[model samples]
Target: MDYRYKVVDLFSGAGGLSLGFLQTKKYDIKVAFENSPYMQETYKKNHTGVEVQGDVCAADYADIVRRYGKIDVVIGGPPCQGFSNANRQKNHAISQNNKLVKQYLRAILELQPKAFVMENVSMLKSEVHRFYMEKGDEEIVKRCNIPVKDTFLHLLDGAFLFDGAIDIVKDENLINQYLWPEADYFELNVIYKSAKNISKMINALDHHKKKLESLIETYTNLKGDDHIAEEARKAFSAIKAYYDGTLPADEIKSKIEPSVMIQRMLSKAQEIFQNNIIVDEYVQGSDLAAKIRSFAVYDYLKDILTAPENNYVIYSDVLCAADYGAPQKRMRFVVIGIKRDISEKIALPKGSYDADEYRTVKDAIGDLEDIKPVYTLAEDKQGIVLPKAENLSELASTLRDSPVLHNHIVTKTTDTALERFRALKPGQNFHCLDDSLKTNTYTDAKRTQNTIYQRLKYDEPSGTVVNVRKSMWIHPEHDRAISIREAARLQTFPDSFVFYGSKDKQYQQVGNAVPPIMAKAIAKKLAKILSKKRNADAKKNCTKGNGRQSHKRNSQHKHVAYPQH
Candidate 1:
């Protein structure tokens, strides 16, 4: 009990997870790695004794061991925004964000911590969330039984490049007669020819600059071409004229401007560009389809960590933060791995609180309701005084540990935002607002999530706390955004633990944090398993030295060995 286990936190954001383990009083966070400058400042300010490294990708695990001795536990929540179901971008395959998961696993592989915990979005369990197969991943992909199929790799909006089979329609009349009218087809033909001619002229003139310059200089005197808009034709001619000192520099801008007709043509060209599809090969799939390579992220993680060489027995499950007393229903995928040599048993922590017993918004932040929040990051040396309220809830009382309060900052609301905020009731969001109030807001307001502009209900736990400031989370009763401190309270951070950064960044730090209450439960469970192993090892060593222990006593506490793949 006197010994404190050494731990290293990777992708540590504002030291939330680290704080939870530190609260158990059984672990010492020796080192932490965070990439954001603001997050680094916040982490360093809170975790003063721990060394803070920059990027998790640049972390050298062997060097970490050499400097801090053996790291008993490794814990981190690698960035999972790319894996989020809400992401609508085209960079889903092999994005830079997804690689950090591998970096986290690399730490366990090199540092070989007795126990390591990885937390990420619950969507990580989905089959759609996958990483593109890289070189040397074929064997592992097949071994994991991960489903793989050929999919067109998107290059841009509605544009894709596939290295697989494809069919091309050869009937020209099918497009000209059925797809578009005669006028539309003629306009497209003119645009295509004009663009082709312009490109050919530009390339042919490259080697005959003097003649091209002379021709361009006299173009203003020539009759306008019927094939393209005058503006489009002038733009091509003005380019050489401007460089040859024939056209006034100031006039070049006006001459090169595209007319409405040309603009329409350019818009059509953009659609064509977006519709463009390219593939490396056109062969159809068969038994040869086995050559099409790709792998799901979770499959690869399980394959590598559970291998005999890695010596880990890992268990993964979706855990709700509310189950651990946080006033938010944030669900995260948690993976806990123990060194197989340390113990064959894999025990994840069971929730201590059920649905009826879960903490609510009022229990977490009801006390700070009337207090006016500041709109800036400047700290008051005297610190804002908190009002004394009687019979504060346990969660609220635990959060009011600091004598002075900080980070009670809110975003300045506009009149438009204020009107929308006032219209919402507890448990209502943007969707509840009147149609007149929703105008000119989101690009597509109807498709907006229910979480946007959410007003928390006093009796219920809040939804996942994203950047409340960005989401403009309305206060339960007040017609204003929830303060950064309020959001942090929902995540179970004590008042004394201050966040350092811009107001927006501070809100982001809070949103991205693992609820400390949940983290503490996991940490406590790990500590118990690790402590049991340590005691068992100690008893065996003593028994060997003395040669006095009976075989029956040893057999009663024998470690069970499980089969590893």
Candidate 2:
């Protein structure tokens, strides 16, 4: 009646996902499983009450089930090697046969919680290689048997339904043989022939279809193998059909026409796809809107159709840390699953600040009086230390040859260079480097003024913080690279969230982590949903009897122990 749920986090690296869900207030993370000792230690340090287990694969899921009767949600990201685009490029077979992905799937099947949220890089949607390899002479022969226009429509329709929904018919032969049989084709031909304008669109569609077919053939012959040829052939043919007006007229009129609504949808879709941080690779399609909508809708159906009444709701624009008041730009994919039997509309949390009132780097860490730069030789030595004044004997003596010291030789600035350094502000890049002092690195041979590194300004947001040391993230004014704390602050990591490992490891963790603010935002939404469900359950039970009312009050009391704020 109190509407509280327990969560089990798998692959809980630094408890980012766990933090997000806990922030939601509706669920309490009872136990979390992380394989890395470093990560586990960090998780334990930050989360005092929750149990942190090691090695999810080694840990007994059955034992967990026994300990925590029924887990309301199982949330975490599996190591997405198999579905990654990089893996696919290296070895398609190996990538496709990724054991970890299958293991993750097995875990989900075994756990059978009310619902689960699986997040991964977008490369999982890469065009299946088998689809491309089969686009050869055999496909051409198949197209010749069916009217090209009908074939195009069938393919698009199939893609829309299959990739866009969970209820896709798995048997390819059944789909090919029964769904779009020859009779259906003749029916479509008759309809096309009867309508004049529709016939014109059909003709245009046919022309593009033929052209695509030819291209597929050419590509296939050049490769001298049928592998992936069919897929390539089909994918191109589908695109041609959509663009050339061969797709169903009704669908086009309703959704694809260049109307204001369609335009806005397209624009939004483009923005979503473009800004998607997880998947940065090639996508072959004219309309990104169609693809994103298809995927989102498909995921919704997959999660919702057979789910319990209150188990799931579709959420979007779930901001990562940078989107809220955090100075760092960490974005992530968020999908929440709530039990439907509970009556509640799970609303997302309001942002901590308005867009104009966002927090900056200075606001996050400027008050930390000890602002000395330190590096690390060993993984364990990484941490924030206090800085000392320039002329102090103790300060100069402490600057030894450990990896934890900032060792940039202070530049003796000429009048011109000094003026340039003074003039440059935070967030400004090497472009502000004085013309006279510029030199080019080998990597920037073709570019002008390439060998310039600048210090960060206090007021502005830091550039993308990456693990690679010789890239864009140099200090704006200082000759040295930005300190670990500086990088963490930029990423909106709270001063309290300590990172473990050496300097390099710290950088990697900071760079790789989901911004805390982003995690907090997602958590807020989850909390609101849980609260609503709890109140609704309380009301429902009150009608049943006074006994149930007592249970509801007890649950509410338990919830108060873990304050939402």
The top-ranked prediction according to lDDT is 1
**Best-fitting candidate, measured by TM-score?**
1
| Residue-wise C-alpha lDDT for candidate 2, range 240-280, written one tens digit per residue | 45656686643433322122121122222232333331222
Residue pairs that clash (backbone atoms under 3 angstroms), model 1:
none
Cα RMSD of all models vs. native, in order, equals 12.6, 18.5
Worst window of 10 by summed lDDT in candidate 1: 161-170
What's the distance in Å from true for residue 284, model 1? 10
List candidate 2 stretches off by more than 4 Å: 1-4, 20-27, 54-60, 79-311, 318-320, 343-347, 350-352, 368-370, 377-425, 428-457, 463-465, 468-472, 547-565
RMSD of 1: 12.6
- State, as a TM-score between 0 and 1, how close model 1 is to the true structure: 0.74
Which 10-residue window of candidate 2 scores lowest in summed lDDT? 147-156
